[model samples]
Target: MKGLLPPPGAVRLLSIGGLVRTTGFGIMTSISVLYFTRSVGLSAAQVGIGLTIAGGCGIAASVISGRVADAVGARNTAITLVLIQSLAVCGYAFVTSFTGFVIAVSVVLSCHSAAEAARGALVAGLIPAEGRVRARAYLHSVTNAGLSIGAVSGGVALQADTQGVYVGLILACGALFASSGLLYMLLPQVEPVAAPSGRGSWEVWRDRPFLLFAGLNAILAANDTVLVVVLPIWIAQQTEAPLAVFSVVLIFNTLMVVLFQVRASKTTSDIPGGARAMRRSGVLFAVCFALWAFASGQPAWLAVVALLAGAVVHTLGELLWGAGAWTLAYEMAPDHAQGQYQGVFTMSTQLETMVMPVAGTMLILPAGSLGWLLFALLLLVAGLAAPAVARRHTNRHTNRQGTPSWN
Candidate 1:
């Protein structure tokens, strides 16, 4: 394997761009509900509907953007999307009705989603394979840091007025768009890889290991949604703690990402075994869920302690799964079809987004215990199965080459 480090310049540019974009996203998301309800005078149901529509449109846009990246080049595609996204943010200021607000938000969400796919593909295109995972980790770390700051600042901005919120978002969008342009200039222009003979999206299914990875990723992604959506609801319903305590937990989670993600990346870099890392992450996540379950039984103070412990475990799993997953995606992809493969991989997260609402509802229903239990069981199964699948896949590859191997 090549040395497990990205070019210093590439790392710097990608991390900076990631931070700026995440900050913008965080700022906007932090106030979206309030803005829609108060500023646009939308009912709660209308806001939910708008969010649903926006999410569906965003997924479709992400899929299309991957193809656009392949056609026009990742850097150019990203630049175009960011520009549109910036305009969309500014357009929010003009929204005076429910319909207009939905349209503006949908446009912005779609552009942001598309830009994210382009950025992921761009990073994969630029960084060396051995270091891609760590590079992505660095990006994630910077993104989390930016999000923490933006979320806080967004709340402060909202205290001013509707106009102030719109102005703040507009500036946030402008900064992100400008950062995208600068990053584009810094990234070395490289020709897209030639398409493989007779290659198509269907060909990706031929790789069993990659398919398995995607399935496992979808499950993990569902868990991620639970963390963001369900956990807070559960906390509020079960404890006397203020909602601000949930914010404190999130801050701790983000702080860990900012401080420890890179270190975790380096630690996982030399493993040469994505399945092993994934298994470890799975175990940690199981423990995290167990801690969360225990939290329900504790007093408020102990509940906070449980929440913090669970957050640490969950964050560790996040670091491990992230570094491992991207590395596996990069390694399994054929040289000529990286963009297509990356697009398919990116779709797994989209699928997760779609599944989250359903899963969250199921988990909090009358059979909540059973729901959490089932979720935990699924994670354990995926974790246990991954290493075996990896070993089998490796052995099969070796056998095809007529070589004995210890996978």
Candidate 2:
């Protein structure tokens, strides 16, 4: 029984490291805009530009870091990146000018992206294949719990509005990262699983079917953005649900993830299973969106019922989609280049976040119910297309046995 799980020591270290790192980040996130606007005296536009640039650089760094992980080792690379990230995060407290802010942001984001990529690869190396998705699911739950704690702590700082609190939180986050870096250093090193054919990172780009899979993943990942950016606005403008329902919806989503994410992952052990899960999630999303569409102009009580129903359905879709996407991303990557593949896979999320807010708003907010209907239709198409895409990749790559493992 013990042999079926990851080493207890390794699991403990990883869990602790994630807890500290996420909690610290969460503390800053809730008030980051306030810090940039009030403390740093940056205009809203400047802050947006800085963040956009930072995000772009971070996504690129993730892919590049994969190459580094393959050449060196995932554990060593993750540890180094975390240490550098900690230093860069500390530097954020000192920046006064726009240029300084941009530079600091770039450095912090680059290091953070690279560290995340290496960490994912390291975990894949450490945990047995059978337990990998479950391990990731557990980590995801820990992250949400840590985020809730951080958000509450940050909200307190926001309320205090004192310079010391602001500076202290920033420095404290850096110190936490440093602690995580030290913990990562203590973990046993995992060797890079080089490609059997010695394929380069370029091969990943050349794989058209895999590229399509990643692109589709990015599109589907926009579900997260929709929940964050669109749901609140839609509830206010289109639905008669009470304003307080927005907060309820947020709690519902987080609680659902924390409770059911592991259970969902258990359904998806391989790529085919993952694709099927994702497709089913897409169908659920389409149904949920359709329900949301009908909430527009409904009576208050009816709207509340409809919105609540939609939220439950939406949460189910999210749980399944997240589990399937994580499994697909891990299983479809070449074992030897897991870091690079995972990094490339993460680009879908980056791209989704970068594009979805404006696009989704434009799509759903303008035409009202018609907009939601259109959006739902798009998801339906994507859902139906996912399985066919996976099958195509499987057929193409399975011949020589160099194909990425679906199992």
What are the clash counts of all predictions, listed in order?
A: 0, 1
Clashes of 2: 1
Candidate 2 per-residue lDDT over residues 230-335, each given as its tens digit: 8889988778888898798889888878777778889998878888888988898889888888888999999888888889999998888888878877877777
lDDT of 2 at 38: 90
Work out the TM-score per prediction.
Answer: 0.89, 0.94
Q: Model 1 over residues 145-233: C-alpha lDDT tens digits?
A: 77877788788888876756666676666677666666677788745777767766445668777788778877766667878887888
Each model's Cα RMSD: 3.5, 2.9
Off by over 4 Å in 2: 1-7, 399-407
Q: What is the lDDT of residue 66 in candidate 1?
A: 75
